[model samples]
Target chain A: MVRLSLAMILCLLMVTSGCGKAPSESSSKIKSQDPASVQNKGTIGFSALTLTNPFFKVIADNMQEEAAKHGYELIVLSAERDVKKQADHVDEFLVKGVSAIILNPCDSNGIGPAIKKANDKGVPVFTNDIKYDGDEGKVVCHVATDNYQGGKLAGEAMVKLLGDSGGKVAILHFPQAESCQLRVKGFHEIVNAHNGKTKNAKIEVVATLDGGGVRDEGFKGTKDVIESNPDLAAIFAINDPSALGARAALEAAGKADQVTIIAFDGQQIGKQAILEGKILCDPIQFPDQIGKVTIEQIIKYFNGDDVKTEILIPSKLHYKEDAEKDPLLKG
Target chain B: MIFMLLLLVILFSVLTVKQQHPTGANAGDQVGKTILAQYGKGARVLVVTRDTEEDRGFAQAAIDRLKAAGADVLGQVNGSAIDARKTIESILAEGQTIDAIAANDVTAKWTVYDRFPSVGSAKCVTPKPYMWPNFLKLSNLMSVANQTAIYAIIAIGMTMVIITAGIDLSVGSLVALASVSSAIFIRDYCGGTEASVTMVVLGAFVGIGICAAAGAFNGLMVTAFQIPPFIVTLGMMMMASGLSFRLAEGRSIPELPSAFFWLGRGQTFGLPNPVLLMIVLYLLAHFVMSRMVFGRYIYSIGGNEEAARLSGVPVKRVLLAVYMICGALAGLGGIMLTSQLSAGDPKFGLMYELEVIAAVVVGGTSLMGGQGKIFGTLIGAFIIAVIKNGMNLTDVDPFNQKIVLGAVLTAAVLIDRLKRHA
Candidate 1:
């Protein structure tokens, strides 16, 4: 038995050691490129919350374009919605000696230590889309949509669609996200304000279900809401995925035309739904613009220009009429 | 097993070919240029990825795109984020400018910060502490331990089934059913002003009873009809999953009472309640499997069913009892998981059976019959959890992590075979 155990340990050591050698040997073979022959532009590292969300991907694409235009290299990393991975990505950026780090935090509070580390290293960390709940000085600037304003826009669109005589409405919400919460608050405040002033047009929110900002959860939440409130007039979804899911649920329930759906995050699917007349309108946050402005701010910081601490990009309301006309709304 | 490994390699390589080599021949340069335009001109780009064929294809595609855009393309390196950092360091040591790096997001994140000198204006990403301020490390350890404990609880029951020369594929589904049923019962019946700890305990018992009954049914069918355990458990698995969905009505049951939540999320003596429960269960299982007559009978039956029967062992009743115990454990795991999430999600415990079985097999438990230890299964459960947590901490891509885990599992079994031969 002892001999067998020793032999097994030996085999295990051999396999691990063999696996370790291949990477190091390949790394050794890498020769430096001739500096005299090639132009050396600066590199910028960007850590996105997730590329699975087309919204974040669009922002990343825009950042890449802006970086290229400025004769700079942009390295993009996806955090896949993991706070720890995002923290690690920031560390990688610090190691690469990149000029600046652009962060899209998966969790605002969870990214504090990582941002603090970047601050300690003297690396300027810029936030995009989502703000980090860390030391204020640690993050140089935050570029994101005015989510509350977007939600108010959604509210106004719903009111306009319903006219003076407002009916029952349901909300598919993601309460966990700060941005989503702001959106919901803005929406509720607007509708309540409208209701207080105008007695004839009363917009009563009949059901509010947690959609969790995903297709499956949104579908389930919407289905349950529909089962309880059959006479629901309109549904406001926090994001495109939830809106699409709500649309699916409505169609499955055979109440497709009965409810007017308004959504946020004017993604391609949401725009398609608008054009198809399934959804009334969508508040479009310009992810590409957010990305472009983020890089521009980094360049400003590099050029010794004073940068703004907070930049709010306004969201545009896109209805069916604007789907084909507006470049941003077009898929 | 070798053939399976070869097939996976070939399949991944084929997938790599499809992803790398675009079908549009005439528009290749146009497409490449468009893709490369995002990175801009005069940037020296390095691509780092795993040594797998798939990653190689991605690297090659990136190189082709960068070259078409008139950028100085640094050669591709095959390794993890740390190795990529080393390669970048080597290049930098020779005074080459690294303008940009292109790799999968996870790898790029790790490689981008290699040897970042802390200039007056520069910052550093803090290295996570391992030993000091033991609280942080302990918390992380506890999180991983808690996860392992849940899997270990289920796997302990699976170990019993495997020892008796049987398998229970329905454990995962049973977990979902138990979670959903208990949550629904607690919320609908035992909820509101009259809610009490007794009610919560009763709800748990009812849920566990349902699971035990389902397990008893599986055992009876296996013994009475002389059907294979695999087929019977497979059927039960589907049936239970469907029932869970039907009962849940496709929505998660939330807002369980605090007492119920304590069973999953509470802590005792600085350890998670689930972990404490897991340790206690392991002790009980150890006693049952090692010190009891039932445990011996299980081993005897697994060693040779015909001989055990000839020796007057009641094989059918033991098999029946074994499955019931497995079911009850699965129910316990379900309740714990549901409590942890603070909801009874119909989607809970998805594909958990495969993980449980893998843990059992990796713990040196022979599938052919008995010959396993409860302590070994506990170790196996921790091994899987640690690997998962380590990979997440290291920023390994989720896709590549799967490959690494599979390789580790295969290597473990291969080493076991080698040891046996020796």
Candidate 2:
């Protein structure tokens, strides 16, 4: 009896919720698109790792525009880093009879079965940013930034900055992400090689702590390293957010002028920071390019063309000079 | 709760109505029949379809029907558009004129025919799509059930725990611990993919055993030392989560034996293993909660612990058993999730503690103590699952989906409060 009353109240409230669903054309009808509008080749479904991050939102927006130009519609959904929820999205895409499915897999291994399910249904799967490392599923193509190359650029910047006078350095790392691991690895290789040649100007390696690739951890980690190494010359953070976090930590400790921070991922904020001389420089990634190129590959796959299994977009280093002339940061 | 579930069913069904494309042998038969009616018997036909289970059925049925109708079936290409293009190019080179191209909706939409004007999409006959709610589809329904099975399984234990004025926040972390430990056991000790079924089963038990130990520790803290259940389980949650990450070295253990996959992915009696397991566990839980003496003791303690203790009820024992059972079921849920996703990662059960607790609260389970049914939790699980599934089907904004879920949970609690007052 209690449940019945609960049901009645819920019905009244949720009815409005259901009705407020935006009217979208009943898609994936299998029939040809209406002869009036652009004959949509097919709908493409994208299950992003998450859309809360502007990084993925950029990719989704670009993909939508690019797909529309090619006469295809894009249905973008965020899995919020839940592999099971991503799997459910794949199932829905399959039931909708979409042309292709794309994802930034939450878990490289755990998302295997979900991709495999799409493969069984004859729908091709593509990945961006995060690669599916598991062997169970087949992804037609993966489009992502070259993180290692970006890290190498960061290393070059570091060597240029601290190679003249040897100074102590700390690393704020996010080890869980494979991309970050590659970045740190590349950074280490360059630093080690630079140290091998110049003993007089050796940049002594200092504390390496996990920054969780986010602001709070980055701030805390930076605080810890500065306390231990008061003469810390520089901090190399994996991404823009963490770099900003390190800046905050340094400011809090009144050592903002003492430590130079080099971060990867030249997002708008990061570029603005470089312009303001907060960060030294950053290796910028083109999320827009990743999104556009992914659509091109999807077109090629459906157009009876051989598509490359992996496409890596290289990152470029941006200095304060470039940030001054950057179009994206102007407004 | 059942009435709410039924209403949700009707709500989603009405909202998600759309044209569903025909597939399988029936789709093939429809296409073949259309071809026969168009060009009549003695017509030469070519078939094109992608390589999939449904396409396979469609190809077989279409070929069978065309041949039975005395139509001259040419060649069938069951693969990508490239394969179809290759076949069509060769057929043209061989001077074979195709009268009709039998295809499904997917193949019919292909642009391969545009290259050969003589054999264009105009000559293709596809099965007509029928209007139906996507929610009502058998596959979608099964997926909803399969998706909810893990949560429902854990909710059974949570129901009991919540009934005793206690919360078990560690269930989510215990799930991850079980998944990673069980996976690691199989990969390292059982020879990975080459392990026998027995070895894999043993690995799973090892995973469960560790979580059970954690739960017992929680029970010990709560009963022996007089700690709050919240604080005890909360501490356990972090420790279990940290331990899993340390054991896994912050990487997913994907090298588990295939024999272990049967627990999560395999189906029994046409239902997924997790869903079937949920049903069986719920029945057992229902029996124990209502029909057993120990069940009465639990209720007596929850109803009034000091009074029940004076009346000779073993309060401490019952509470300890409840926490242990909660932990064990969480372990089971972890294993089931590992099987379902085909790998166990430290990232598997993020935020699942709140999800389960929401299920318990929505099922009319009171946080104050000693009320709620085993079956009520099941309905609550289904309610959450249906909302999620419906939102996905309707293409409602994912952000809005979160808002709706929060609203539903809040409403359920509010309604429960109102009912008590009334």
Candidate 3:
């Protein structure tokens, strides 16, 4: 009887809560928004993979700035690299009746459902930094770095450093990410082409290790590679953290001066590494531009204008010589 | 029981706060029309969050805005993402159509792709296979089994410790230390080459040996100094974790031989080796706990320590032996985990002790000691694994998943208490 009564009360409570407020009270609160001064522009939501990553944070800030300029209220949420959390953020946006949503997908495939939900709701969705695996038409646009181009630039720089007498090289990479895979593809293709044409210039990839895209994994993987391949001439790290890890391992082995290191992601540490001559050069991405472009696409969508489906923001090469001159290298 | 009732009341109040005072009847239609103007008349919004005061506030605000916008506010669910999805499923089961859902981005993404299959692109890409059908697949079953197997192995020892009215909080840390030590030994002495049968066995022994030594040290400290088991084990936990970190030098040891992985990831006759090993260990634990004299002594000691001592039971020796056995099991668990990940990370087995302990407790082991079953602990481990697998398959929000898990555990204990009283 006690359990039954408790359950009954719970049911009653749930029903009452579901239909608690009348239309007049909520409508009155809604009228508080002055229709005269403020343009009733729709709200735009952004779901970032994580704000802890300075790159993503910069993009989010830029998107906010761009949204304000377009007279739209921006709502930013961080997924903290969890796909489930990102999905929830999208749901929240849909509930708030946001005009559009910008996503930095934690996983391309995992974001399919969220994109589908927005598509059904007629709320345009845009992806920044990563592409979602849903229907092509579902997403209004994808704003991201041209990672393949960045890799090509890195490879070209390596060729210049090698000076047509290329030696054995080690590649530290995170193979799981599509962006990283593209970077590796570009780097490998360029190096292979260079080797095939140039006599006496053979850039043999002695080892390819998975750095798991983190400093600790990079450090450990590099240490293992260095132990196995002491004759390594150069190391190409897919990102700044991996390069830093390799640098630490090389320093520990007292062979830091022997190998030329090139990395992607012109992070603060990587730039310092370049200035310190530890790293040859880094390919830096324009995250702020990506964020601004994402919002621009959303505005275009709202204006019933055709928005390009894909936008590749080019990455720049940051060298030790340019560190002092280029504000981009200031991290 | 009182605490359980109080918690339920608090949960009820929090859930019903918005419903306590309904707005004017005419206000509902006005707000609904407003929502229709913004979105559409057919728009249905479902709001969800983890059951917390703060999350509820967010849900309420969204509900208010949704109401103001003239949207058909379906309801607010304060539970796991899986629970929210289940609610949607039930609503759909009753033939009620849902148009939209509101949640934090993570939960929203997972629920939409996982639950509302008709609307989204059919192809849902996830790092791990999360389809509901996949949960029943042999490979996924094996994956779940593999996870449960490790926890069950560790929980076997934890059950023993709890049976004696003692706790071993350092088992997780011990697993890390053992794994790191074995990895280092294998790399240095065995050439870190492809796993041969001999190398795998040698590595296992080395890892288990290190864990046993650590366990012995814990036992000696607890028995010799007459220190509380909690304090002793807690100290051991930190010391073992520090040792693991120091040995690995803040890096993971990867590239273990294929033979080593065979113990973790390998299948024999469609069953993972780890699952097989877990079953064998459980059988052994069952025998030791139910049929052996040592087990009887442990029970007596826990039931009445003074009486057991007066009855000439070598309490110190038995306690020491029990701890060593627990350590050995933890060592074995570590070796298997290392083989599974193909890496011995110092950060491996982080907070795993809590899970193992929870498994033991949920299996009906009393903290005050004196009663428990190895089979029950095994079931407890599987329960946890199943919950996790189900949540993943259903695309439950990870944060909300934690809440659901906590609630289930509490309810389990409460049910056990009610049974005791009845």
Candidate 4:
């Protein structure tokens, strides 16, 4: 028991350390373009939806690191998750004379005016994570993972674990993130397609719960699902943290083996769970890579290079066997 | 109180006509030049100013800046006497495209500010005009409801305790702890099948029960140890926060049941449920404080604790109940917050106690232990919310929002103080 606890602590420390240095090292490797060689003379301003979310932090950190390596400064501002604040931030960036801007907009529509302003400024803008409802010419690029595809894979994994017999499966979700909505769509579609996959595995997508993406919420959300669905076959979480929390509740109630758990976001803890055979599988997203891609596109645009408007970064689907093989999850 | 209201009316009147100028976005020669990057020879600008050489020179300076930047100065409004309606009407009569409007040396009043006709596709920028209706709006009202509900829940209970000459510093931290606990429960039980709702209710009750126990513990500390309620609750606040973090491992709980979400998101007849809950609670509190004999005991205790005890009031029991009630309300707030976010996070509602205290004090509740009303607190919350929401609509920066909240809080308190003196 002592050895196991020590192993877990060491693993968590390694993950934390890896997170801190990956960006700075990655950016340092990218050769800095000479200012004299700067045929692409323009600024790129990167504004995030909020600085509060650690998810956004990982993306922003990577973008800044890569941009710095390319000898370009990424003007970063936190909109604090307010749509209006994001709009104002965009407008301010526009007024500052940027060549192009990368926006992780807080709202789908509130950012339209700022987009227009940037358009008027003759600076190309790219959106990440969120899709904007505006003219294609107004935006230069939109890069994001196929959240729906990832969610479908999660559903498939759940069905495989539960078999052709259908049972109740509760989903812990976030309403604010459109990505979650896409995931829900995919999960429902995939589950419906798999008839008789289990003897009685009639997939009931229970309440679309909002965990607000917090741990205590994860715990509470999982506990609620379990209590509400006594015969629940499996739980599908939007993210790994929620999955870990659900695991905690299941352990507490001594129902650990009875219910299968599947989740999105191949976070470190989720990887640990998969390796231990506690969870079915987790679909991993490369947020840092997404950030790097966005930065690269901005740099390319500044260099008079035409880049694709949409960039799709692939997700890694990891089962227990795959997770155990990964060096990041190795002892 | 009457004098304060009278002064507000007077202040409102004086502030309205005292200063008038287009402070918000209005296209002018300067704005046109900035936007166009070169003054258009045929561009129109509406300049609002006093009919004096100095005022005209300022307007001209702006015009020159615009022209140099690339815009034509087309029109001007020289009002020697300030009349918002008449002033705006005169500007429209000029037949110039209102490219940008700039207010010079004028206080913006709410009544005259709202009278400006459609800006006609021109960008308008001006100092925010203070309007009563804008101050009392839906968005602003919602923000106030959120901010006020955070503080008022605890404050109402604190008022009852303080009226009995007791203090509860722990109420703040207790609120945080309870919120964290509730957040944890709701996050776990929120998305399940039919039982999810039942699970969430159970979690809420358990979380509240934990808070009530914390309150009861406070009562026991004071009663058993003969310790001051102030010291006891203050100590509890620190310990509670520590316990919450230990339980949560510094993680925030996010997911929660939709039913609880309704507490934060639900609206009846265009008002947020949290605000509606606050009103209902306030009314209930008012009734309990004014109509019940317990209310009389509380006031008597505040006026003279020893005398109330001598007069046959169960002073110790009342004190304990008061603290317990305060704790429970704090727990209720935590639960409501859980509903709002649909998550249980131990770290949630941290430092919210201060805001609650501020609302209580600002609501004309005497911190000296007795004088206050639930209705006054509701108004206090409104005032804070108006400043925040109004600032948001006017495009004030977030940092500025804090400064504005501080200023409004101070002003409200000052107004109350003045009333006392008057």
Best by TM-score: 2
DockQ of predicted candidate 1: 0.03
- Cα lDDT of candidate 3 equals 0.72
Task: Give chain B TM-scores in order.
Answer: 0.68, 0.97, 0.68, 0.64
Q: Which order, best to worst by lDDT?
A: 2, 1, 3, 4
TM-score of 2: 0.93
Candidate 1: misplaced stretches above 4 Å?
Answer: A1-152, A155-263, A271-280, A285-315, A319-331, B1-143, B180-203, B226-273, B300-312, B338-348, B410-422
User: Considering every candidate listed, which one attains the maximal DockQ?
Assistant: 2
TM-score against truth, every candidate = 0.52, 0.93, 0.49, 0.45
Clashes of each: 14, 0, 38, 66
* Candidate 3 lDDT for residue B361: 70
- Worst-scoring 10-residue span by lDDT in model 3 chain A: A16-25
Evaluate candidate 4 and give its CAPRI docking class based on DockQ. Answer: incorrect
Candidate 1 contains a number of clashing pairs equal to 14
lDDT of 4 at A109: 42
On the 0 to 100 scale, the lDDT of residue A199 in model 4 is: 43
Return whichever of 2 and 4 wins on lDDT.
Answer: 2
Ranking by TM-score: 2, 1, 3, 4
What class would a CAPRI assessor give candidate 3's docking? incorrect
Q: Model 4 over residues A1-331: C-alpha lDDT tens digits? A: 3234323433432343344335433432341342232222233677787766667778888987887676565656676654444654554454333446888865564455567656654456788978775342267789888898888888778777655667778888876577888887888888877754444557777666776555678789888878877877888888888778888888988889888888888777778888988778987788899899998877665333557889877676789888868897854
Question: Can you write out model 2's per-residue Cα lDDT over A209-263, one digit (the tens) per residue?
Answer: 8998899999999988988899999999999899999999999999999899999
Native contacts present in each candidate (fraction): 0.00, 0.49, 0.00, 0.00
